[model samples]
Target: MPHTYLVFVWHMHQPFYKDLATGEYQLPWTRMHALKDYYGMVEMLEEFPSIRQTFNLVPSMMVQIEEYAKGEALDPFLHRALKPAEELTDSEQEFILKYFFQANPSRMVYRYSRYGELYDAWRAAEGNVERLRRSLGAPGMRDLQVLSQLAWFDEIFQENDPEVRQLNEKGRDFTLEDQALMGRKQLEIIGHVLPAYRRMALKGQVELSVTPYYHPILPLLCDSNIALQSHPGVPLPRRFQYPGDARLQVHKALDYAEEKLGFRPQGMWPSEGSVSDEVLALAYDEGVRWMATDNGVLGATLSSLAGVRETYRPYVWKQDGREMRMIFRDHFLSDLIGFVYSRMDARAAAHHFLDRIRENARVLHNEGRDAMVPVILDGENAWEHFDHNGRPFLKELYRLISEDPGLSAVTVSEALERIPATELPRIHPGSWINANYDIWIGAEEDNQAWEYLLDARQTYDRVVNGPEGAALSEAGKAMALEELLIAEGSDWCWWYGPQHHSENRPEFDKLFRDHLAHVYRALELSPPEHLSRTILRIATPAYQQPPSGLISPRIDGEISSYFEWMGSGIYSPDHRQGAMHGRDNAVREVRYGSDGQKLFLRVDLEQQKPGALAGLEVRVIVKSVRHESELHATLLENGAKGTVVRSTRKRTLGAEVSCAYSQIFEMSVDLLSMGGRSAEMIQLQMSLWRDGLPLEAAPAQGWLELVPSEPSDWE
Candidate 1:
């Protein structure tokens, strides 16, 4: 039996982070991601010549790239984007010299013609930047052309350039501006890199698609209330009717794709395969004929709509009883490649992927329906894990698929045109994250966060709905909208994971409160006197301080402070762990608590702790379950800092401190290399240590809730 396997990969993303005022990106990961994967994948297709795939470029990411394309001095922007390393390793410095245009022959030749050396020499000299600055005078679109030309030269070192080393350095500190600039550069590079794809796409060799701006979870974006309830403490990054925002995102993204690629994309890939009826309607409003979600969403939808067996293939999603040609990705296979195949040899993995599709096609043939397999996944990050940098695996997969007569590949848009509008299913409101929504919800800490958000949401509604809110001016409305957008960020809730609260809970609370405060002010509402001071207290630094009963250890960087009360009106260290994670170079900052039952420990991570492990392990005897016990860990590192509870047990308070350690390698050293369930368990334990000691122990005046895990044997 012959079957056409349509492998469609919809790459969806947003700027890693956005500036509050300018809406500009603050992190380059998004743009760098496009350059490394989105553009790379498109360009790679030139080799297959016949292979086709779908991509969804978010408008927000494109906007940043566009800014790069319009820059006056590419070099300065590039330098700003790629923050200079504070202390580069010898190897890193060598790579910089080896790959940079000034030192590397390949890069110099690729970027410059005969003048490459002159440009390189100018770049090498401190005065040269000033000279080049004078020569350029002002930044503009033409400067982008010059930069674009020079970027081509950088291809020689694009993969091995020193910038990546800094980006990957988890423990290093980066200034906020540097982080923002890096993000801009990353996007600019992507804009520059995409021309390679635009060339192919222009030649009708590949197909492109667009997604909603910022790549937010569409269903959540459409309705903040849903997110608030499902994931209580999570902050919404933007404010607006989600449906309207989603429509805007899609329209803008599609428009940008058209402008950049010289053609409108035929389909759309909702961010993270996130979807729902509201999202579907927004897609319709945006003129997007097709969208894709994880196969799990489709199956769940089919079970609700038809109560029949569902298959992983392209289908038409209908709204108001109308067909909406939509596609479902074989998430299992897709994840296998994106998550697992990278770990396998290219030949074996590629063959296995093809075999899986072949098996699925055979099954579809029996069912008498043409099967379209969307083998979509991240184009970058996944590649680094592959041997030979994913070249072998990708090349092999392309070779086999293109040459195999039995198999055929088509872009998602083209495939949709071939399929007829059929019976539709109700897609459950969800995303490709955890099925239960625990990733974004269910943590107690998150619940607390949500309580704050709910207040903000309600207040905003009142302001807009009430006389005060109605009094807002156009400028006021815009400012309020900006505040609302920041409030909707998903990072706040996401920081708390797998349990009671995320470490970034405090930030989430602050952001939500601040936004509400702004809305309140815009509406000219005088808080009912009492609430004014309370709101101010929550919104101001008055309510924030270091934890109690902990001593500061001598370290070089910054430290984080965390404290939480679970109804008792007493600060307990255990309850506050989830409020801190990913903070670097921490020593005890301050500790404040009264009763022996309650304690606060403020830790700081300044200089690197000598022989610091990524995490630590502590043990306590498991006493009777009657005793209430909890364990939390904090990291004081770089500029960002926080704390998290590694484990909690009643009567079994003994657990390890689960700090986001400085040495991820040391954390992985114990377990990742081996197999077997018990071994894996042991490895997992090693990776998630609760407590014992810091990588380096220091003594200061802070409180410690150090306790035994079990009760006395005599008792």
Candidate 2:
């Protein structure tokens, strides 16, 4: 049959957030996206069963979603948002103000009157939390908290669920009970995320593929030196030659997909469409029959582009008796949806996309050759910027495709089956970005990060290969290797360098260092001092600074001396979008220090309270590769000592600690438990809770790091 075979591989991924040493999830992105994107992306397909597409699910992302779906992940964002507004502390309030409005304002926030009003007030405040807090007040903040979560709920849920629809109707002045219900509803929606995809895959409406475990650049992992072939004279990081690691990742992807999807996926989308000759051979050896990357890689490999004839055909990369089918994505058509279509009317955008696709295939159809147009891009991130999460456009696109006879929306595997494969003699070693590894390796920060990783990998090899490794437990060996693999993922470096920008860059940098440090900590060895510091060679102007020296402060609510915190590291929360992530503020600043024996933390609120502000309380949390502890205290409760709950590598709680609050909030924590090295990265954060709802938090953009004791250090 002469048809334009459209293969859509929607790559869905987010940064790995789980701490290898502790089972805690560091960010709420995976869970948050599940509410808006994951379930609905597949469930929407049932309406147009005639159209089939491929979804490239990263195993790590699926793990987080499954954890969330089972009511297992402890999401701080969800807890704070659902908390009763009256009881929220200054920190919780500030956190809600900053993060809840993270959606595209016009598309998501401004859709509702209350959310729009709050967002406008937030913008007027110019990142001043106190001014914003004063303008919006608690009632306004509460309305925003509810609406933010409600706005992200899928259109299906919005239309079908009575309570959800009722809340949408109410739109303003929501109750405490309503906030709680929304929190519960989020998990309820996330629970359907996996099942929806599974059902659709089970019914053969879609095919599920996977990226390599941890989503590392497979080509770079096989040999970092390959990057030079694609981008000549680029400042190179030390060679990270490990084809075995690349193969293991591919093997794990197949094993995990079979376990989760009931069959080993034949198609693999090398992370970010990254590939090399070595990676291709590794994937094929691991039983991958086909893979898809960007047209750029195909363009670079084939060395010339002779129009749609070169791009719109399936290619067989066969060399040295190893062969695999490959599809080069239609970059122009894919970009129209991912970057351009969001601004246009939904029906218009969908029509324009189809028109371009049909026009592209006309010459092929005239020559009696079926056009294999592979459209590939991110499945999740682009929608939030679009009107109604791009549902109307997708529905319109799906309907038009269902009605069209000359075009057939098919999976990558289906498209390959219908087209004769052209032999691709070779491929350029590069990623989807500019046909090079520049995003992960070129800049000063990226190069420095890669060098650190190489050092960590060398240390792991030395330790595991030495005679001392004889005493290393099997668990310890596995942990060290696992942490190393996670550090090798492409996301950490994505935030590094000059190419991309994220407010969470510091957090990403710290996590990457932490992962490298854990490779040592997992073996009960001391990590190098370099890992204790920031890898961000450059950053925004200062208000936040690392610790200069050590200090010990009293736990009393009142400040006793001016010099008490003089030497401590400080985080004056900057709510400006680029400086830190939060929009509203209740917490003014946080001071971090360690007095050789115990870690010290002091939280300063925007305003001082006399004794008890009705229902205000504070929670101090510390997370490290060794242990995770959370402490709590009621506002100005003179001698009322606070309690602690801890999480360690065993993922169990077995700790009791104390803290005090009155004029100021102060606490001391034993950073490590169970007689282990504490060289891994430490994060400290304080949030205010009032009426059982979190109000504000210090260092709202990300957590403050508590350095391994010596000279005090915190970022």
- Assess the local accuracy of residue 352 in candidate 1 as a C-alpha lDDT between 0 and 100: 95
Q: Write the per-residue lDDT of candidate 1 for residues 1-715, one digit (tens) a residue.
A: 5466666674645433443433434333444454545556666676788887666666665655565556522332244324334333333322232223322234223333433533454456544334443443222112222233233322223545466444333212334443454455454555555676677667766677776655555666566455553345755433334466556666766777777778777677776677777778767766777777766666566554211124445577666755567777777887898788866777999999888778767766777766667766655556545554566788898889888887778877677666544557556666666322455544554454445555555666666767765568867666655455445545455555444343224434434444445544454542111111111111111122322332322122223222232111111122112111112323322222222221222232233553353333321111112322223333323221222232232222222212233421110011111111211111011111212211211121111223211222212
lDDT by residue for model 2 (650-696), tens = 53333434456666667776654523344556677776654333345
The 10-residue segment of model 2 with minimum total lDDT is 575-584
Local distance difference test, candidate 1? 0.47
The TM-scores, one per candidate, come to 0.56, 0.78
In model 1, the runs with Cα more than 4 Å from the true position are 22-26, 68-191, 221-266, 304-309, 319-321, 366-369, 419-422, 434-436, 445-454, 457-473, 486-492, 499-715
lDDT (Cα, 0-100) at 20 in candidate 1: 41
RMSD of 1: 16.4
Name the candidate that leads on TM-score: 2
Candidate 1: TM-score?
A: 0.56
